[model samples]
Target: MSGLRVIPTWRHGREWLYVCGEDGGTVAWYDREADRVSLLDEARGGDALEALRPFLVGSVAVGPPPVPTPAELAGLALHPDDDLAPNRPGEHLAVALDRDPGPPRRLRADPRRRALAAQQRVGEVLDGLEAAGWRVLHAVPLPGGTYVHHLVIGPGGLYALHTVPARGRRVRVADPFVTIGRAEPQPLLRRARADASRCSYALTAEVHPALVLVTPSSAVPPAPHLFTDTTLPTLARTGGHLKPADVEALHMLARDRGTWTRA
Candidate 1:
């Protein structure tokens, strides 16, 4: 499979880098020494992969932009889903468009307008993260469906799940199991901060840029090189761990964790 060879989201000494080769192949790496930035080892995955490439190849940084304020970080938080809570635990942050210093922004009612609105919601979430100081590395799709929006955020590399309910048919299957879920505002953020070493960073992710794998059950084995090398602080936020049953639908076109990857 000739494609991008990203370092499985990893960490160096005190920093993290998002490595990308050609296609969507990416990896996160960080350590104490030996830093190199540039594309290397272009080939199919697994055995054929060249082991000589350094982790930080060609500026492999992850997460969104950087800002430092809880209020600002609120922008990156997922839209209020009062329905799914405790697991998601907070309501301090909100997603909104940038301040244009003009008239009120409106979302049209046309089909294209609808798509634009959805994309805008996602953009607002990412923007909120940037304003709060988080380096959004790269977004990867989770296998199974387009609905499973899997993302790798921060330097330490954590799995973030974005469920686009409206795009359900576009990517995922019609699974009655996976429905809109939510996390407690405070606890979820607390968990995320602890995971990033108290670095409460940004909380937005680039929309469905790549596809991913959706494990039916924890016992099921995922594809090779499928997971990252980071330690998750809490499973409080959904999408960090792979449970086979959670995934029921998927999009055929998404590339990140897609099944279309030529191997």
Candidate 2:
């Protein structure tokens, strides 16, 4: 107890403070959002409470950790290698760039780099929604070499998002086609919808498709399925489709890499 320490950590956008013993083992943890302190070593409860006194905001429930839900148990049983929960926004692209970064002196910036930037930007906004009862999975791989940019689950339902880099460019959408700046139009919406369909088939739930534009100068027509980085957080304000437990179960399933092998 002489070397007790309080260490802070973040997960799913929630803050947790762990009280550690002299041997660097967690004796207790304080969940700030839940307003609870769970003791791993009941004998050290006094030391843990003392270490966390400076960080506690108000009166909090102090006791043993709650029993794990079915989803939590499943997630805990998953092997790290087969878990997609740790993936960043542009996980595949990040790995590719790390392995073979291409010519350093190219005349133009790599398009993959632009796409990765867009994904990361959108991912930040989605990650922030975790506090609002939303769960997001990034870079979900499919049967082929393709991937869904991001999969979101919440009270608003599920969505498969595809990110488009339109920094400072006008965007036009006509059903399946999307035109950006002076570039030729592409059927990006169709691809997004297809990805959502695949996700639905894999998860046995209706997954909506959305095309997310990053920093677009302007997006015309304002379709329901079209979103910008600035407007994406609005999804968190939507509810009525699922409860907390359903969201957790879907998230646990979505984070398992094996769940997408047949999609």
Top lDDT hit: 2
Compared with the true structure, what per-residue lDDT tens digits does model 2 show for residues 26-145? 678899999999987898888889989999998999999889799966864665567787788999999999998999999999999999999999999998899899988899999889
Worst 10 residues of 1 by lDDT: 83-92
Model 2, which residues run further than 4 Å from truth? 1-11, 15-65
- Tens digits of per-residue lDDT, candidate 1, 1-263, equal 43433332222112333344443334222332444332223232232223324433554323323442443233213122211111111111111112222344545333333333443344334333432222232222222322222233432233443312243222222222222123112222222222232111222222222212222122212322222111112222334332222111111012222122221
TM-score per candidate: 0.22, 0.79
Whole-model Cα lDDT of every candidate shown, in order:
0.27, 0.88
Instruction: Note the clash tally of each candidate.
Output: 78, 0
**What TM-score should be assigned to candidate 2?**
0.79
Give the best candidate by TM-score.
Answer: 2
User: lDDT for model 1, on a 0 to 1 scale?
Assistant: 0.27
